[model samples]
Target: MLYTAYRKYITFFLILFIRLAAFSQGNAGGNTVQTVEIEPGKSINFKATSTPGSAYQWFKDGNPISGATSPTLNVSEPGEYKVLAQNNLNCTSEISDGFIVTVKTSVLVKQANLSVEKKSETKATSINDPYEYLITVKNSGPDPATEVIIKDILPEGLIFKNMTMALQGKFDYNAAARTLTWTIDKLNSADMSELRFVTEAVNPGSVVNTATVSATEADPDLSDNSSTDTKSITDLTIPNVFTPNGDGVNDRFEIKNLEFYKENEISIINRWGNSVYEKKDYQNLWDGTGLDEGTYFFVLKVKNATGTWQAYKGYITLLRSKTAQ
Candidate 1:
């Protein structure tokens, strides 16, 4: 009986020692993570060495990342990432040292650059003239851009007419704000989106339009985000003098940029206030036929489909040389 009791005690002590050794090994060391740096759109995987039967919860910048319960972590954004491991025995280990990831600009893979540019179909415009503006967005990228948005601010000297585009996206114009906005879900690398809008040149001067572009991803270059276009304006250009001597050089009194206006009423009055000539839609066809050559007063009434009419009165000189054709 004494021999059997001693044997039982030895067995118990041996089991205790084994259990203690396993427990000590379970919590022996802390996790070690090396810092990493990667180019944009690149990911870095983190590895850890720690106790057995441990659970892991990953964090980014001290915020717990949901559904991240693995020994390895894949990180793309630049920030401080860490993991918390807890064993099944209910003993929690200290949070592992963080992995500081730096997302540097890519040299081989050119970073995304979203740019916008505007162009007018007509080089110059005049009041009451309708013209179209082509706004283009080009993406110079080794990476794609998502949630792209474009804002086009129209100048005050223009009246918005209409807009059109081929890309599948939501586009809107706020007349009160004089702003046009476009929202695209995604823009792939080397892709371009062209949108066109028509506007009437309202008041004269220099009409300037600007377009701005942005994306959800980080853009290495922002200098191309915005672009501008300027169009010269002339309300009306009428010659003050003309020599209608049949020389065909200065034979007719014509108005520049008058073809843009379809509706017009022109009247010519002599020095004695006599109505010498009058016509509708004057085609620059006046050759001073049967009219005395001298200084004359003229009145021009121009009308546009937009329900706008402007009147211009000025002095015009009609000189006829002594040698007539």
Candidate 2:
């Protein structure tokens, strides 16, 4: 009878031990359902809670995934996934709540081709003369462009006066930096816009103005992104007659627009080819002082900072009396 009682006690303890072990395994590691989103060409990694000396098994949609026994799984396709963990003593945990992955549609990029052209209304200009420049931006593409920007910086010897008009955008000019910027919200395919920029000539030389265009879309061609316009400037107006009779009107041997050329030399010769008067860096102040009333020859040489001296020979008839002969 004692032997039978001992055997019953052993069976009761065995059942209790099995129940405790099963409870411990259920609380070891598990998680709720998670949702993951990815693009068409993108992927995501699925991870499971890891325990020491534990093996893993993954399932997709209530089916066991073949050869997917790692703690982390690299998932590229959309599906519902679940994982289970087994300890060293062969105790298996409950299946996890798992994950729900959804693939998102891919978005295509916009492609566009932008070009710019700059041209001056006049090829030649004089100092302090106002001129106009036409800047055009064109877009040729299968898609529209956004946030279009055009930049045109005036070079030295040119001063920005103002913009005549802008077809489809706003322009801002910084006088101190000589920069003109235009911004457009959107530009449709096969469409074009223009800007008429007016400027004044400050110095005498070749003024090259370059304008460039850009947009928020991918550009296939870059060859026509920028355009350059060049202009030649000069101002040397010489007079043939002058009266140095102390009168305020026409009193000096003044050369119109000669002040624009800072480096210049002038010399006056008599009918006998004798040098009567000469001056360097002339300020148009020659009044034929201490000279007789007769016809004389004058030679004027002027040059800019980047050029050699250019000579202009002419005849000057000096008249001091109130009336001519």
Candidate 3:
């Protein structure tokens, strides 16, 4: 009876030991399974609790990951992960809880094509005239563009005044630098935006204004990325009739808006095509002196900012009182 009782006790202890060993291997070290979601081109970190002088091994879907012996794992793929720690004595701890990392599919393309167009209704403008330039930016893309930047540096002879109400994004103009900058947070595919730049003509010449566009995405076509608009500036008005009778009103052969040009020449001729008077740098002081004028022809030539002379030929009727000395 004593031998049988001892054998029964040994059998009970063996069963208990087997259960304990299984429990230790499957127990989670104060960790719970967590689901992590990440987008494409992104990564997530899986960190395990650390113990002094301990080595770690990480597993993905029950398979041991090569070289994954650190306390932390940077995961970029979709998988179920778990980690186990082994102390200096080579005593392995329980497997930690699983981490399920899932990746989200990308919905947009990586590259986008952008273009810009600049235009003005006033192709020909005069000095002190207010005009507007419309700058349009388009996204012909397979994806949305972010952080769109548009830059337009105004050429000389154009003065920035202000911009009209913008449809998308914001704009700023630096008068000192003559630069206009527009910024948009996002521009979707097949989308377009516009900016109206109001300005004034301050000088004379052919003005070429260009606008360029860029974005965070890569543009396939750079040829259409920039657009240019050209405008001509001229300010002069000739009078058909003038009274040189010294009446303090229309007393001299004065031309409207002629003082703006410093370099000019004027020549007057009679009905017989004989030169009656000629002067360089004419100051509107000619009173048709030494000639009784009824009607005459005049040729006026003025030099522009480009040093090109522009000529104006027309008939001028000079009226002098019959009793004038």
Top TM-score: which candidate number?
Answer: 2
Question: Which portions of model 2 miss their true places by more than 4 Å?
Answer: 1-31, 36-42, 47-56, 85-93, 102-126, 129-132, 146-186, 194-198, 205-325
Error of 3 at 193 (Å): 1.0
Least accurate stretch of 10 residues (summed lDDT) in model 3? 14-23
TM values, all candidates:
0.44, 0.45, 0.43
Model 2: how far is 35 from its true place, Å?
A: 3.9
Off by over 4 Å in 3: 1-109, 237-325
Worst 10-residue lDDT window for candidate 2 reads 21-30
User: lDDT per residue, candidate 2, 38-153, as tens digits?
Assistant: 88878876555534326878888889999999766778888987767665655555566556788997778898799999998743355786879999999998899899999998
Candidate 1 per-residue lDDT, tens place, 56-126, comes to: 77889899999998766777898878666555655444565555788887555435689988887653345
* Candidate 3 C-alpha lDDT tens digits along 255-277: 76778779999999999999998
Judging by lDDT against the true structure, name the best candidate. Answer: 2
Clashing pairs in 1: none
State the local distance difference test value for candidate 3: 0.77
